[model samples]
Target chain A: MKKSWSHESKEYKIYVVLCLILGLAIAAAGLYALQKLLVPKYMRGVVEGSMIAEYYESEVPHEVLFLGDCEVYENISTVALYRDYGISSYIRGSAQQLTWQSYYLLEDTLRYETPEVVVFNVLALKYGEPQSESYNRMTLDGMRWSRSKWDAINASMTEGEHMADYLFPLLRYHSRWDELRSTDFEYAFSRDRVTVNGYYMRCDISPEGEFPAPMPLADYTLPETSMDYLTRMVELCRENDIELILIKAPTLYPYWYEEWDAQVRAFAQEYNVPYINYINLRDNIGLDMSVDTYDAGLHLNLTGAEKFADYIGQYLVNHYELTDFRDVADVARAWEDDILFYDELRDAQNAELAEYGELRSWGANAIEN
Target chain B: MNKKILSVMMASVMALSIAACASEDEDTAPVVLSGGQTAESAEGSGAQEAGETAAASADAYVFTYNGIEIRMNAPANGIIEALGDGYTYFEAPSCAYEGMDKVYTYNSIVVRSYTMDGEDYIAAVELKDDTVATAEGIRIGSTEDEVRAAYGEDGQPGTAGIEYTLGDSFISFIFENGKVVAITYTAIVG
Candidate 1:
């Protein structure tokens, strides 16, 4: 009887192992199916696509890169920097990139093409309320990149929560995925020969004595992670013999009340990086600081960015002694090639502008040369 | 005797499972159709201009069919039709992650429409050697910097004026006006 019982137990063990193996296999298959359903929404027509399409397909390239929310994407045009002052930079940023997510993206993509300068946009202060609809890309993470690209993906994520964005994307931004796919998504953005000028972020606005005043962050207290990323970015720049510069793009909508300006100001001072908050620079930057809003005063148009880039460009040339690449014929010619995408991009933007005048948001501007 | 019975039962169960899996595999099989893009291309690679659309060769496929370039690319996954002058198309994306070759062929299909037609499509397109347009399609409202802080720097007015090039249909901001009075949208085709 004892031997019989032992044999029965062995039989059960064999059955359990088989069942476990089968379950794992099925789960893996299901996961692959989910990925197939979701990934294409963002990465369609990746091959032989446009120039900017090619840039995003690869890792970050510029020395000091910009990564954050769409505020950066819509606000900053790296090409503007290249054209205005010949600052060879790239926008590694998009809309709604949370501090947690972009920090990892920077870390992930940094190793491939590290930048000496890093620009980040602050958001969590005003819209800390998770339900407060975000005006930018809000993906938590990405997944299933190929073997060679796997390192970039991992580096981008760092220690950030790998959360549902990868495994359960349908839960967070399914509608966004569906809606965005309607347009041409570079699907895979490469950075070769890219003309990117990344910059822009704004403070919220208040009516006359509405909140008493625009209380900017006295001392901007950034997430330890953002600060750490900044530090790492600075160090990386040092290692590469690159100079790091920080700019806080101005906003009509001040995210931080003037009270907190101390924290942000002190932090900028402590880091020894130039902090040009357009709040104070409205007059300084020569911007009217009164009438540049299109979306209930949420963001700026090309008019504002040109002035801002020009201001920053002059500063770089005067103080940093940066070269004006376009002064030479070949350099100007190179810059012209970057505009090859402007037309395609314009078509894409035309669609958005048609949806809502002045409030047209930023998105993929082209699908071709 | 009991051990023998148990082993035989277990073996029988395992056999039944294997048979069930086999049947399931046979139950649901996918059929792949060689849509017009690939098949037509190769066969027509040598055939020149079927109707002036211009095919490289007999096996080449032209992006035609009422001047719509949306669904012809992915004939199977989604459908596209016109909504008045504007047309919209939806399709599964064709993405190649890093070195992977179309591990993902189709999914996340979307439909888009524009108010413009073929002439607009062509006109908007800044072909090689074409001039850019800075002043053609730009309009400006008030120079509300209050709006600038809220929206973004992309559309705010500056000392620089809008720059357009009819030489190539190009548009750039030139900071001529005290504010950004002009902005331009270009083209989409390669």
Candidate 2:
């Protein structure tokens, strides 16, 4: 009886071993499944193109995609893109994006949908020293762009400066970032009323209401790396049969130089694409530099965007006029509404900011005509 | 008596071993016989069938939301058609789990390709009540009558019967003992 009992105990030991093995196997499998389903998941502020790729290729197919830094993002309005130029576009641009960053964004856009025209911002080199971090502005893996995702682990040069941009956007953009706190993309698409001189959209003024002066320009050369990316931007557009339009966005007067304008001309000739310098279009574009500039002259005030938009809108309408959305019923309503928004903004900025850029304070004062 | 004793002892050992193993590899999805909706308020035959399918569908999930099993991403496409409303779509990238190097937080959606077994599904989950504030999105807290009213009469029974072509609004209902407890709305932005 003792020997038989011993044999049974041995059987029990084997069963327990087997059960543990089985449990471990199932745990591993569960882990595998979970990882498979979750790892590729992304948080917000990711490259917008990755999510909207098929959508672009499918809907409102366009020939031009404007790529640039924050200036490119906030300055050019997509609503204006369609209404003014009849070109459907996505703001593949981000706030404070550098040329390198623009390169990746353009790469992502072109990867899925090949546009007929590729517009890029070239003022990056003329600003400060070449900033590679500016070019790396694609959304990182976390809620907002995180510093951990940047290659700044072991003290790289020019690491923390631009890296602080995505992390503490408020640091780089100051009051403007506050204006954009949760600025949804729906602003333009939702047909929200835009006041040209609305306090929210206006540049900040000093307590004395003095408009700040614009930053100075440099004959500074693009870093070799930055220039390489710039060249690649043109080459890629050429290879993909995309027409590259090099644009020098308008700056407040005295901040620009003639030598810089010549540099742009040389590059445009080499690339063989039409380069429209707002500087060149300065007087001819028929815009008032004083009233049009928001913060004295760094960027275009709503007044400026209106006239400048008019210039580009008419230029494109005449040159690459697709369909006069003004006539299409459903879309016409949207276009007319956008035009109406432009008017509201135009009126908003034209008003005196007695409330200190509190132009929107006169909300009911600037009601639709 | 000896044979009976041996059988009892063997059975006890086997049961303990199995239980021990299971506890170590435990998954958290409550196993209330997913084949039938959690015996919630099943007031009618239609409710009963819906309850059954809901249970079965939920039981298959090894994940939980707010400590309850994750049903189909609520407010799925079918309910949107019934509501006769439209929604905007937003897609985000997938996140993998960090420490173990496994992705535990992916929402169950086939976004990019067949290889995407699990990608974060950002669509709002619809609740039966459509009013539970669970912080995930808009939760549903209405009853069956309220759900039918919010969704309209066109909401056909079962997942296949529901038409989501109109847009992506998920209509999720909670039923206990076959009677509807709550209805929620999970807005599925593309």
Candidate 3:
């Protein structure tokens, strides 16, 4: 008689246990592989999604950490800071990164390293509540699992977002299976570095054009939520003995209202934090918007970012005691790698421009979405 | 035997999940058709001259000025041309990338256009003064009751005003002392 499988048999029991373990391992591996395949590669156009994760790969310490929106990420060049002033800095910036998100990111950064100075751009203060989900994902998705990431997700989720979606991004991005491309498979295990210490480079030039008149607003007051986060950021930095410098980058599209600037200035005064509105200091910074801006007057091109970095680096070195990383051998070697990456990115962008008259690989024209 | 069945079932479930995604992949596949071209550039090149007109015919929140139908989310060039050059223009660059957010102010009304992808679409039309009114006859000076009578009570009321959402756009009215102080037709951009 063919003996039926018996739980009483030790051999049979061992086989069953092994089978169960194998099944679980397979299930877990399958899900992980699926996740790797479905998630956006962010290689082509919208590379901002990859910026947050790149911070973990930094082997060198940074003395300056920048936080905020594209105004910080796209407007300032970190490599230029390193090259010119030997000021080691990193930009923990994302597209339209909100104030609370910045606060949470600052918290996350302190977990690993505390920079001497934290520079925060003030333009994101205009947004009071949670904005778009896509923008939120671009800001929050690359963050590694931590208490700060958890809080950031809780604070940043839009109406339709759920905790589970962020927890298993596979669940949120499962529908992206159809959009999978060659790059998705190529980068499934690892992704190419998108930013140079968080600097998004654009070499193409579009002169500043005539902008529309600023629309009158119903309310001029900055949101209490943003103000509270700013206060929390100040307190957090104060606790860590870190200097928080507030700045408004010199971009002339979103119309930095006098009322808004006045409020930020008042907050800075009350908190005794230094505030710089670069719009007022455009000439002093030697910014020529006509040739400097790549997208009309929205953001600075590579040349403009280098100029802004030089100006900010001067202020940083003058005001705060930042490390001259060039003198340190190990740190200098790491930064030299970064400088090479920056140069390569600039060359690639410039090459494309020379061929296509515009950046076909990196700019608005290259956006996959 | 039961243990083997359970393990197989667990493995099968995960396998099914993977298979299901593969099966639905074709339906959701993204098709990249062409390169970027601004609406103005397309119009100038005569490749998409009728595209905005086609979009205009779709159901939209419209603010008609001098019989020229200005539809929300439709290209702004046609309406601007029909409305003539009598209006003042102001433009601001978008936050993310290329393109501009444009505002055209005529004597009585203001038309705002936003950029998506690389094209300019009418984002909002504001009746700045009492001189202009919606096609439904609701003007800046219309009473709240008059607006309610025309738009129905389905409007989402807030501290600022009441907004009636229609498809992808909304008609908002700012009320002061039970009277409509401002009126706007706006597209909802996520």
Candidate 4:
């Protein structure tokens, strides 16, 4: 009877161990589900917020890294670069991304793989400090955990933001419980690609309206803080033997002031880097502002983006000696898939514009709540 | 056998604890007051009075000053259509104020829109010409004392105005030289 009791005890121990394992697995799954439900699914609307995070999903190595605010992401077509120049690229950009944020993003990119050229738009140089928390989250949230992400969060945090909120996003997004939609659950585990190599496509057109005249700034000089980060970006690229090119994309509305352009030009010259102001070359680049722009003059639609990309692609090829990989079967095959996606996205957006009279399924208005 | 029982009990307790925490979150979730009325009032209010008020205000702008049901980030197309087409759209020049891009004016009713992520959303609604009044009959020209009487202790005084918090919304009365210059309703969203 004592021997039977010992055997029974051993069986009980096995049962307890099995139950413990089951309980732990359930607990881990519950937490993961909760985390997924609380996070923003940028699938439906405000897709620019999803662009920065999409970079981590790319398995292919990028030869060029484009960093800037909306002007870079919206203005250049990465698909065009790949299809035409065979130069794979990614744009790490968000709305009003500050210079320091750009620097940190570049740092993060370096941690993954070093690109041959780092193209930074000078438009972000206007702001010396973090602009808004919403914009900051769009840029920072999708970044994988690393020292670079930590520094980016610290550098980009505005007043009232906490490091802990970023560490465990459930704290910040707990309030989203009431605002949850089907997309939240559907995309909890994964997200659809919002950009093709960081290019957001807009097929609709809204011609440029009369922009309010550029008001003279109290101080025309680019902020010292922004200049310091620009210097850091240049130094980082130099250390890594990556060519740093500064370009001001040709968006007419924000009024790239002559004074601001001059400051960027002087900085580029001082650093011995190439500065290309596309604003001056709009005519030469065969851009028709009336038809090319989607939202008045703020950003280029798909048409303008392709044209601009074609121009920039030629320049990148000539200046950087970038290879045309159309001959290479593997690279061409990957690009063909990307082109298919690009065509599908453009067709979908155009169809949406046709059916709805405006993009209903995709912009801010798409959020049901 | 005792040790096995204890382990099983502990696992059960842990699972229940997580469920309890989740339930607590749901229980405390902010109740979205819909259609300018609370759920309790909808069910508990006298049917006759509720029907009468609903029918009377059917065509009128359903302004709820209590709990500030006005939303700032909503598309203004519906609200503008409701307010009728006497409004003119005015674009505030670049750098006028951060985020604020345009204002729609109809008599004394003004709706301001702010640009975020390159799209416009209604940010503020103001009644400045005494053409519109709150559900409580408070208008732009109302005195501080009148506002105090209408809103009672719900409003807390700020530097230049008095703000009343209703749920996730705020109804603010801006006073200049002891007279209310504007009455604004805004809904805050994260």
Please report the candidate that would top DockQ against the real structure: 3
Model 1 docking grade: incorrect
lDDT of 4: 0.73
Between candidates 1 and 3, name the one with more favorable lDDT: 3
Q: Model 4, range B1-190, lDDT digits (tens) per residue? A: 6676567766765775454344333322222111112111213223343343234443223353222233455544434444556767656322201243566776666676555433344566777567668888888678888888888876766656888866545678878777787777664544
DockQ, every prediction: 0.02, 0.01, 0.17, 0.05
lDDT of 4 by residue, A189-211 (tens): 98899888888888878776766
Name the candidate that leads on lDDT. 3
Off by over 4 Å in 3: A1-5, B1-12, B15-63, B68-108, B114-122, B126-190
TM-score of chain A of each: 0.60, 0.57, 0.97, 0.92
Shift of residue B160 alpha carbon in model 2, Å: 74
Better of 1 and 3 by TM-score: 3
Clashing pairs in 3: A211-B91, A212-B90, A212-B91, A212-B92
Better of 2 and 3 by lDDT: 3
For candidate 1, write residues A122-153 as lDDT tens digits: 55323321211111112323312334234333
lDDT string for model 3 (A83-202, tens) is 999999999998789999999999999999999999999999988899766677777888988999999999988776778778876767777756677888999999999899998888
Q: Is candidate 3 or candidate 4 better by DockQ?
A: 3
lDDT of 3 at B78: 62
